[model samples]
Target chain A: MRVPRPNRAQLGAGALVLAALSVGRVVTEWLPEDPSPVRAFERTTTLDREVHLRYGNLRVTEVDGGKQLATSTSAMLSPGLWVTAHVDFTPTVDKVGPAYAELRDGEGRVLTRGSRNVLECKVINPGISGHCLVAFEVDPTALAGSHLALTVNVNDQRGDDMAVVDLGITPAQVATWKARTTPVELLMPKDAT
Target chain B: MAPVGMDGGTDSLRATGRWGRARQWLATLTVRQWLLAAFLLVLVGSSPFGGLRAQRAEATPTLSVGVEQTVAPVRLTVTKVRFGSDLGVPQAAKIDGRYVVVFAKVTGTDEKRSVPMYDALRDLLRIEQVPGVTKPFSTDPEPSSDDLRPDTILVADDAERMGDLAPGLTYTLAFVWRQAPGQPVPTSVRVAAYSHTFRQASIDDTYDWRDATRAAVGTFPATAYEKPAAS
Candidate 1:
């Protein structure tokens, strides 16, 4: 016939529990889905053709690497080889963000520019074309048929529109490059030749 | 039927008595006691949210212009602000309104590594037309007298000029902001440089611009403005 009322302390505790559950639920529901590191992206077999992206077109001219790492001042040795891609960017957007390179090997090993030494060229303006070198220091053995993924507007953190360039390096080509690897002089884009 | 009616009446009386007793209990507390109880309730109510946050000290002072402001690898100086109507620029280069050009110098202070000065510079340099709001305009929106690279903060190096700073180098750069159509040109403006950690996602791109250490380069009066003939 009678109902027992909860005291202030008990009511407050219940409210606190409810808020905690709500906050937890929102966090779980709103967090971005983790991208699969091994997931396949749209692949471009050729690099010279204009690869269209949301902001602009990119033409990756060359992708090369071996054991030798060279700078103007000195040459350094690495446990793995360096992979460099010379890319030309033509912007179509007003505020263009920076782009980074990722290297994925057949064994599912992935390496980003953050993980290795690199010299990058930035394309920030839309009025003129820009060139950048996105390099990654990766395991020399992984060079056999690895994919060099270039994602533009990387700072936007949207994580879409990646141009995956297949390195197309055969095991024999890797062997030849390894045997003939020479110390490369790190030069400015103008002095790259 | 008679017993059911009696039971219903008893239940109603019991509910009324319970509420009356609750109100009587509340009335017995003095004003000071009531205030204390209310404060305690608020404190307990906020405990879950408040307890989670670590207490932080006051924020760092904002950096001012005419002074060299350093944030780790990058050191910036905002030297001057100039306003122009036509700017003697090419027709294609002209904006819908006017141009407020800011001249600043950035140097890479770190000897160990080359700072991505362009990314930091873009994020740090801003024109404060109003007090708090910073307008986002395209940097070097159009072609100009100086041969400027679209992506670079530097003009194509002439016989005398050096471009964006390499490590241990200081380079002077200009940023151009356009006045919105129908908006009066700002008579007085403040140029500000922000200090932030050099992350791949740039300070401006990732965090709130206010959170960074803001250094006001300088405030300029109307006399500093320049007017050039439009093509």
Candidate 2:
């Protein structure tokens, strides 16, 4: 005579597992630690770029944050990145002091030694005014699909916060996915309370 | 009144015989098959699932979200921000009112949404009363801020970009939840403003900061940017 396998017990265990899966789904929503919206994220970034500067005539226009939508281009690279930010300012007040500007990577590592100069402006709106223009460049070693965060450092006061923007190296049709995600605000009349 | 037909005893016996046949047939069915038949009968039955569904419903409670809707307008405030070398603000301001980008995050169970700065400011967004133009541009997002909300179309002649908005112009935006239609419209938003400041003149002794400002002036950067809500 041969010993029989406990097929009935095996069936009972399988049934229990199925029941657990069902109940687990029921309670998933109640978990507090879950990330609110479902997102597609990678384990490590391929590319990362950042820009920084300070306030005054030399680098007047600060764009604390901007956005870049996903591109339809090939996203197979380990890390590929590119960012272009332009700012223009008029220096009406000539400052005898030399100002410095440079771009920094996410790790707080300086990508390039900063360069600077003075502005020429005759019009003074506040204490004084001058004209100036500046641009920040980043290394293309970051993930193309990842976000760009940058800051401007001048004097001792660094940019108050990070300006966030998205990168759209993907195809144009992906623009639709981005458009749908934008917010629609409900505002009051100018004169309303 | 007795007709020649049949006796009461015969009629009673015939009815009892039919009931007996049905009971016998039901008894012959396998236990599993019998249970299946009972389930089917419950499905199409008039008494409504009998009892099984009631227990399941109690154990699996769910909130029906995105069902109701409210057209109620939500109010939000946007400052008339203009920064530049002249602005002397810690941060530079674009002609369209500085702050190239802003990220707004809302909390609570209701959920938060993101819109372009111009779209968020549409309602309260005014052009500071310019002359020459007979009618001003409408303060509405062309692509619409609401994903599911209907769009209010504008004529081609009336189309304009966010760059057209100037500083000193005030604007407000509205928000409403359709699924929660019964909820009241948000009247006002408490705004908290903070600015990051830094300094750098574009002139590398040789770089022409003046020429750059001159170029930026008059011309406009009409790009629109929206930040995703933080998860």
The best candidate by TM-score is 1
Q: What tens-digit string does per-residue lDDT give for candidate 1 at A121-193? A: 6565785777776555555665677776776555543446667777666788677667755854445576332
Task: State the displacement of the C-alpha of residue A90, model 1, in Å, after optimal TM-score superposition.
Answer: 1.6
**Candidate 2 docking band:** incorrect
Q: List all candidate RMSDs to the true structure.
A: 14.8, 23.7
lDDT, model 1, position A23: 100
- Alpha-carbon DockQ of candidate 1: 0.04
Task: List model 1 lDDT by residue over B90-176, tens digit each.
Answer: 421544556566666667664433344344445556665432122443432332322221122322111112222334335566565
lDDT of 2 at A156: 32
Looking at model 1 chain B, report the run of 10 residues with the lowest lDDT sum. Answer: B155-164
Residue B145 CA displacement from its true place in model 1, Å? 54
Query: Residue A20 lDDT in model 2?
Result: 97
lDDT of 2 by residue, A73-160 (tens): 2111101121332333332333322233333343233322222111112233433433322222222332233233333333331324
TM-score of chain B of each: 0.50, 0.23
Cα lDDT of model 2 by residue, B1-231, tens digit? 223234554655666666777776776777678779888787778356454455442221111212211111222222212111112211221223212211111111111111112222222122211111112232222222212221111111111112111111112211211111122222221222211111233643221112111000011121233322445
The fraction of reference A/B contacts recovered in model 2 reads 0.00
Highest DockQ scorer: 1
